[model samples]
Target: MVKTGISYSSLGSPDGTLPAPQEVARHAEQSGLDSLWASDHLATGAPFLESTVALAAAAGSTTRLEVGFGVLQLALRRLSWAAKQIGSLHALAPGRLHLGVGLGGVPADEWQAAGVPVAERARRTDAALRALPSLLTGRTTELPDLPGASVTLAPAVPVPPVWIGGGSPAALRRAATLGDGWLPAAITPEGVAEGLATLAELSGAAGRPVPRVTVTVFAALDGHLGGLSQDALVDVLHGQFGFPRELADAVAVSGPPELIAERIAAYAAAGAEHVVVCPIGGAWELQIELLGKARGLIA
Candidate 1:
């Protein structure tokens, strides 16, 4: 079955406020979401919780719902610190953690705040990905760049499946070579189909299995469900994300639950194994309940 999830770390509400992480998490689990995802950012220029902390809260509040970083900016922190955080979360959540890593899409000032050069993000992320396996498994791992320096985390837990985010060629290559899954956002069904085919070829070339696919959709249910219009969602996609207007209109999933389910099924037909809905309006709780109903229709 196609697993369905919701992104609770959204600032897309009409009033720019969100409920507590634990509350959203419990509600998602009760509402029948398979997982809950949180986006990571150091400085989003808006109200945003730290991803790790938010996921920790979610995980603590629910037993069945998987908690993940929709995409954590690995380069924003020292490799060791990143490993420590992942390891600690793994220890806490055990098999429930899904590690999603990426080079990030936040403003360059966030990178500057972390002392990470913008250009070095990809290199740092790749290095961090390479070193994570060892560090998280209690094996002595040499720190990246500091040859002699090494660290090992205790209470070692299995490294959660890593989903590499972004839809660029470089991202596809990274997912093919280093990730267990590929996560792309604001893309169309045809794009997902094409990306999966590319992933199969790239993974074969790398002598690795093809990665799983997950698509993060930005959406808002119409009527009494979530008070946001299709035009508003399209504008947010086109303006904030710089998607071409046409592409935004085609990709944005809005309107009633039936429409939402149909759009999600299209992605599933295109090869996505999972869909993470990041609802784009207020009435967050109602939107989540409605998303659950859509998931039921797909099931």
Candidate 2:
């Protein structure tokens, strides 16, 4: 079965009045959702919370619901610092944290503020991904640039499953080589099939097992579309994320509950092992309830 999760951050709630993370986590667990995800953003014009803090709040409040960073910008922070944060969270909720790492685009100012050269994001991210497991598991690991320095984490916890997120070929290759899962947002079923094929070829060539696949989608249940038409939703998405209309429409799942369920089923058929539904409007609690119903419809 394709597992389903929901985004816990502010992406879908433009009004900025999202419920407390603890409340959201409790609700998700009670609703029987498989996971809860939060995004990492250094700076943004929109209302947002720090991803790690948000996940920690969620994990601390719930027992069964898996908590994840939808895609933490690993390249922006020092690997040691990132590893420590992840390890701490795992200690708080062992066996229930999923780390999704990626090189995020947009808000170029964030990269500049973080002191991460935009041009070297891939390299920095690759190094972080390669070293995180060792650091989190209490095994000594050396920094790539600081060759003589070695460090190990204390009170080590099981390394969380790391999912790589991005749509570029380099991102796919990185996922095939270093990630336990591949996570990409705003992709169509056909796109997923194509990407999975590429991932399979790359993983086979590298003699690694194929990584699990997950996709994040923007969606709204029929009555909860926030009075926006399909075209209006596309426009809003383009303004917020700069996605082209066609691309936005391709990835936007909306309409009746059954229709939403059908769209997710299509993605599962295309080989997605999990789908993270990001509600695209207010009434988030209602959206979560609706999403749970949709998940029941997926085979």
Best by TM-score: 1
Q: List the residue pairs that clash in candidate 2.
A: none
17-105: candidate 2 lDDT, tens digit per residue: 55788888888888779999998988887677888888989999988999998899988888888889999999999899888988887
Error of 1 at 198 (Å): 0.7
Model 2 misplacement above 4 A: 11-13, 145-147, 222-227
- Model 2 lDDT at residue 152: 85
Whole-model lDDT for model 1 versus the true structure? Answer: 0.88
**Candidate 1: worst-modelled 10 consecutive residues by lDDT:** 220-229
> Native-vs-model 2 lDDT?
0.85
Q: Which stretches of candidate 1 lie over 4 Å from their true place?
A: 223-226
